[model samples]
Structure formats: C-alpha cells, structure tokens
Target chain A: MAGNREFANRRLHSLLGVIPLGIFVIQHLVVNHYATNGVESFNKAANFMGGLPFRIFLETFIIFLPLAYHAIYGIYIAFTAKNNVGRYSYFRNWMFMLQRLTGIITLIFVAWHLWETRIAAARGSDVNFDMMSNILDNPFMVAFYIIGIVSTTFHFANGLWSFAVTWGLTISPRAQRITTYVTMVIFVALSYVGISAILAFV
Target chain B: MAENKNVRFIITRQDNPDSAPYQVEFVLPYRPNMNVISALMEIRRNPVQANGDKTAPITWDMNCLEEVCGACSMVINGKPRQACTALVDQLEQPIRLEPMRTFPVIRDLQVDRSRMFDSLKKVKAWIPIDGTYDLGPGPRMPERKRQWAYELSKCMTCGVCLEACPNVNSSSDYIGPQPLSQVRLFNAHPTGAMNAPERLNAIMGDGGIASCGMSQNCVQSCPKGIPLTTSIAALNRDTTIQSFRNFFGSDR
Candidate 1:
C-alpha cells in the first residue's frame, strides 16, 4: 500500500543518514585531519583511503548512491518543511528547523566539494595535500569551507537526535535530553576536526 | 502573587467563527483558591469589561469542572491546559486566555476539535463488538500491560497536544499525538488486536507517523501525562515490522 511505501522511504532516508553517510562524514574528516601532521601525511592518508581494494565499487555503492539518495530526498524534505521557529521557539523546534536548513546547505557544500575534489580527480588531478591547500588558498574559499564544515557537522549531529527518536532508540524525555548532550558533543568535536583540517590545508 | 484585590484577565475573544479575534480585559474580585474556570464563570455572570463597557457573555465549552473532560482546554498564560485545573494562584497575573489556535476558533476560548475526533475515527480507536449478541470472554492480558494501557486510555481527545505541536497547524494534516496514542491503547486490547494491522496501517501513511518531527511538545503539553512520545516510538517499531510484512506478503 501507499502507506507502507511512504514509511519505508522515510525510514530509508533516516537510516541512510546515519549509516554510511554519517559514518563517511566522520571518516572523511579524520582523513582530512591528517593535514595537521604535515602535507605528506595528509596525502598519505588520502592516498590510503583512495587506494583501497574495490575502491570504485565502494565509492559507487557505499558513498555515491546513498549520498545521491540522501541529498535528493533531503532537498524535498527541506523545501516542504514548514518551519515554525517563530511561534514555537522551543529547543527541539529550532533543531527541527535547523536540520532542514543545514541539510540544504550541506547538500550545496557537498556538491561543490565533490566538484573540486572527486570530479577533478576523475579528470586526472591528484587529490593530494596541495589540491586541498590550493582550494583553501583564498580567504573566501576558506570561509566557505568553514561554514560548510560547520553546517555539515550540525546536520549530522542534530540528525542523530532525530534518528534516535525515529528509530525508537530514545523514547523518554530523559533519554532524549541525554542524546541532545551527546550529539552536541559530536557537533563540537567534528566541527573542530573539520575546521582544523581546513586551516591546516591553508 | 500581587497584593491587588482583583485579578485581571486578558481574554482573546472572537465574536463568531469568521470574525477577527480581539483581546478584552476583565478585572474580577479575587476569590481564594479559584481556578480559571471559576474566573471565566464570574466574567460570564457580569458581562462588563475592565473599562466599564458592557459586552456579550464570554462563550466557552465546559462540562466537568475537573481536568477529565478536556472540554475546557485553552491557552492559559500561553500554555495549553484544562482551565479547570489552572489555579489562579499558580498562574501569574494577569491571566491570559486564548483559544487553541491549532483548530478553528469557534468563539472566545473555544475551538472546534473535530480534527482529533476525525483522527480517532480514522484510526478506529475502539474495539469492535456488538452488545446484541453474547460473545465469549476475551483473552487475558498481563497485569503489567493492562496497567500501562490504562495510562494510554486516559486520553480524553483533548486538543492540547495538537495545540502544542508546531506540525499540527492548519497547513499540515498530521493527526497529532492524541489519536496516535489511542492507536496504541486500542491495539493492546485482546479483541482490538484483531484490527491491529488496520490501525498500524492507518498511521504509516502521509500525515501519519512519518510526519511526526519528534518536537516532543506533545508529551510535555499532555495534561494526562500519557507518555505520548513512547507510544509514537513504539509505533515506529510497529510500523517498521508492518512494512516488512507488507513487503514479504505476510500481513497475516
């Protein structure tokens, strides 16, 4: 029935956010964090990830397919979401609004990022430390990356709170509050890593 | 807590269903241990505004002067609750009363709550049985399950949860939390279990359980403390299983 399909689609959207996509965001940031060690180390980490077995298969299946679905469906959810932060200015209410806003921003950021990195790599440009450094060379790109990183991390973190509720992980208020704190820590920690990596590239 | 001899009320009044709402202030003689309902009654007794102007008697719906009926629900001091239980002493003066705007306001402090009733009908929140024929006794539920089901059954179809939810506004068709909790309540019944799939299917659609943003205002606003979010979460699991069953063609 139509109802079952809708539930399954929404649940798939929620599940894909955490699985593979959320994990990929964290893992991608950690790889970028290797920039703090030096240019050579950053390139080594990037190369190691890029040189994995069945690399194209993994990227197509684990990364691109899920990211495509999450981004496309996420845009639909974002535009359709009726944000009522003005009338109902509660904590979770704001989170509900921000999740949609950040989802859109993160989508744009990810698209531009892939254009600079993966798409360029497909055109034979090496995805080395210098490539990222050149990308962050300008002040505007640096600001853009900083904003993009923060928004992406926030989308993931606040998304974890929603994911917990949607999957029945945190049903009680106390449990939800605890998840809030935990996700806050995640947002802060991931933002730090992501920003530091960008600065290191600079 | 002020030492003023009179309690001031700023009531949002609408003359009719399509009329614009306006606020009218009323100053009433302070009565000890009076609730919002009593204060409204006092205003209705003498239709005089604080400005000494004559006005129509304030219109509202009420039956039981207790919190059970949920008929006297309104936004008192910007919070949705039963006016019967909102003690004047506990609420800060001047008390502000407004209709629950999630539904269409009929008059002063009264909203048409047919949305909730329609949802209850949609979900089939009652067990099906006919009194004309004698049926055998139903299966027994464990004492623990019955205790919790009793809590869920406490819902009075009040629109407080809908009022508190940002998603349940006129723009959205979300059934809100009240009837969703009733789904859990009725589905737990031995005889009602026969229609469990129907109830679960009801909530799995658009404007159904998927529309819940988990803002959690419902649980906080529910006067009955009915663990609404828990019910929704349980339904999340239930609907998940139901979707699988539908996929595998085993909805038996």
Candidate 2:
C-alpha cells in the first residue's frame, strides 16, 4: 500500500539521480567544457545537442521529468533529514549533511540556470557564447556560477557513493571506503571541469 | 596503580523523568582492571561526592556484568558502549558518563529501550508457529547461509548503533538500524521466511528502511560488528523486488 509506494519513490529518487539526472550533469559539463577550446567550438557542441531530433520529447521526459521528481523529493529528504554531524562528526556523517546542503544549492542554481538559458532560448534569445559571456560579465555572477558548479558536482559525486550503497553495490567497510576514495576523485575531477568551463566564459 | 590514588568521575544524573538533569563528580579509590559498573558500585557503597558531601546514591541499570547483556550501554567519554566492558585503565581520566540520548531517559543511565522492543514487535522479528499440534522439524539452511545468518544474530538490542546514527532521535521515528537488521535476520530464517512479505512490507513504510540516510555509522558503532549497512542494502534490493511484484500484481 502506502509503504510500498514510499519505498518505490525513494528508490526512484536514488535511481533517477544516477541514471538520467547524474548522466545529464556529466554530459552538460562536458558540453560546457567545449568552451575551453573557443566560443565557436562551444557553440557548435551546444547547438548540436540542442538540434537533436525529438528534442522536446527528450527534454521533457529524459531531462525535465526526472529532474523535477529528483529535485522535489530531494528537497523533502533534505529538510526531513536529522543531521547529527555536530555529535558524531564521522566522515560519512559530514557527507550526509553536505549531501542535503548541496541538494538545496544545486536546485536553486539549476532553476536560475534554466531561466537564463533554456527558458530564454524558448523566448527568442540565442543560447550562444556571447550569452554565456554576458552572464559571466558580472563578478557576482561569476562567483555564483563557480559555487553553483562546484556544489552540483559535489552533490553528484557524493551521491554516487550513496547510490552504490543503496543499490547494494558496496557492502563491506573496505568496499565503502574504496568508493569514498573513488567518489572523492570524481568530485575533484568534475569540479575542475565545471570551474574551468565557468572561468573560460570570463 | 597506587592503592591510595583515586579515579574522578563526572556523571550526568537526573532525579526523575520529569526533572532536569545535573552533573555530579565523585572520587573513588583507584582499583586495577576496574570497569565502569564496578566503579559505580564503589560510589553506591559510600554515596559520597568529590567535595565530601553526603548525597543520594547514583542510579543506573545493569544485569549481566558482561558485555553480552547490553544493559550497561551508555556514553563513556563521548562514545556509546557497554560500561561493563569499558575498562578503567583504557578510559581517559575524569571519565564522563551520559545516557544514550536516542531513547528517553527513564531515570539516569536507564533509558526506556521500549522503542527498540516496540520496533521488534512491529517487524514481527520472530517465527510464528501454531501451538495446536506439534509441527515437524524445520528445514535446514545451507551451512554457508547459516554462518552468514549467525553474524546477524549477534545483535543484543543495544542502542549503540542508534546512538551513533544521526537519523534516529527523539523527534524522528526512523526506528534506527537495530530493528531493520532484525528484519533481515528473521526474514532469512527458513520458518521465518513465511512472513517475509509482511516484514518487508513493514520496513517499506515511513520511518522504515527509507529513513536510513546511509551515513553508515551504525555498522561501525555496532558492538557485535553486525553488518547493519549490509543488511539495509540487502533489504533495499529485497524491497525493490517486492515493490515490482506488488506493482505487477504477482503473488510470488
């Protein structure tokens, strides 16, 4: 009954995070990394993705729907979570607090990002190099994007660690410790790509 | 270890459930290889404070002086563990004692662990049998599976895992890790498998398995080294399949 639905919803939240949403973050970062080459290179990559067939359907189903559910449910999970970091202060305990925090930050950042880019494009603005450059022209926007990018990457990377445990991939302490290291590497690598791309716009 | 030397203790004490808690310090003559329970007994014998004031004897809970009973669990020097096994030689001076906050403090160190017991009841952590007639012997589990189940069976309903967990608290009804691990234990039993769906369904609800944030402090905090996180993870898979079956209208 209701219990089964709650379990399924939670599993869906975990799954959607790593599947389409997590993959989308990586893909988005890679596409944005193209800006490191030059304005034209970045535009070409962004346009190619934008011009895919069934683009609306893909955005609605693969991207928007899943993102919507993950974000909404994630916010609930974040607020309801009773963080005992102050008392425990264990490695995983701090990560648990950070996961909730980054979830909230990433949600706000993604909302503003969508308003500036995709929503603007739908309203007859071009999503191009100049558009990104104009957005980063302000120092505050630059700092905001940096924070946003780092937060999003940390959320995704740390999330992968929990995802492995949630799916029963890492059972032993040794296995969990190994994934902690692996996910730390992921956070560092993805943050580099994201921060470098944002700086490139500046 | 001189006989004249003494060990100082700062213990948190509450007169009753309705009263506020306060701290009192006691000085006991040093004894070699003394555990927390034995030191408390010394304090109870004289009922004297560090300042030489005659006071009411400190109250706490204990049954088996061994760690197996789990009744002596309290926060010693900020870590939740069995006071029975907490040797005085190993603990820092001025050893601090506090009741496990995850449960409501009935007096001082004695918490109403009925939360954990209630959870065990909720999950039906037992094999139900008809007493009308004598049933035949139960089916035997493979030796390998039996060994694994034995590891999980070591839980003594101690509140250490819950105390270590950030999720379980007075405000939250997450049921912590103890009962969830018990569900895995009972569900694995051959006779207990009859109610697997019921137990799985119990944990599927709110304040159930989904409440586990995977902070994983439970596994590390378990006194018996029960693989709590592993059991929760296995349940994640089991509940996932159970959800699918429920959705597809499959009886199996």
- Could you tell me which 10 consecutive residues in candidate 1 chain A have the lowest summed lDDT? A79-88
Candidate 2 achieves a global lDDT of: 0.89
Per-model tally of clashing residue pairs: 0, 0
**Per-residue lDDT for B70-172 in model 2, tens only?**
8889999989999999999999999999998778888877887888899999888999987789998988887887898999999999899989987786555
Cα lDDT tens digits for candidate 1, B1-252 = 545689999999999899999999999999899999999899889989999999998999898887898899999988889999999999999999999888898988888988889898988888988778898788899899999999998998878888888677656677889989999999988889888999999988777888787777787778999999899988877877777787788839
Predicted candidate 1: what Cα RMSD to the true structure?
A: 3.0
A68-177: candidate 1 lDDT, tens digit per residue: 99988877666655666665677877888888888998889899999999999999999999998889899999999999999999999999988988887877778879
Complex DockQ, candidate 2: 0.58
Best by DockQ: 2
Q: Please provide TM-scores, in order, for all candidate models, with all chains considered together.
A: 0.89, 0.92
**Local distance difference test, candidate 1:** 0.88
Residues A21-122 of candidate 2: C-alpha lDDT, one tens digit per residue = 989999999999999999999999989998999999999988999999999999878877778777678778889999999999999999999999999999
